[model samples]
Target: MSEEPTTPKELSVRSLTGLILSAGLAVVGLFILPVFRSFGLAFRPAFWLVLAIEAVALAGVVISVLTLHRQRTLD
Candidate 1:
């Protein structure tokens, strides 16, 4: 029996960027945010900081999806 060949598709740059941003933000937010709070940046400021990180990550994912769709359409 012959095995069928499978073609591998490369991930788009936007998608990779999204993944990196999401991961980096999560790591930084998890590790660094507490330190900032401990250093005296109390509730509201720290809350806003977390919100900003979440917004950026969400935007990255949205842009990545849009770019991927556009790229596929072009291909």
Candidate 2:
């Protein structure tokens, strides 16, 4: 019996950018945030910094999804 080969799809530029941004944010949230929290710095400027990063990451993901959807519809 012969098996068919599977091909991988390439990510668009926007998709790749969003993936990278989101992954970087995830790393910050997982590592940096906890460190700040452990040091009892959550009430300081660190809170605002983390909040801004989260908001930007969320916006990037949303924009990426919307653009990808529009691109697909246009195609």
lDDT of 2 by residue, 4-70 (tens): 9755544578776786787678567655666777877755677776777788778777777665432
Per-prediction TM-score to the true structure, in the order listed: 0.60, 0.53
Pairs of residues clashing in candidate 2: none
lDDT of 1 by residue, 14-69 (tens): 77777787767766765667876898999789878887887787787677766653
Q: Candidate 1 — which pairs collide?
A: none
Which candidate gets the maximum TM-score versus the true structure? 1
RMSD per candidate (Å) reads: 4.9, 7.0
Error of 1 at 60 (Å): 0.8
TM-score of candidate 2 on Cα atoms, chains taken together: 0.53
Model 2, C-alpha of 9: deviation from truth (Å) = 12
Per-prediction backbone clash count:
0, 0
C-alpha lDDT of all candidate models, in order: 0.72, 0.68
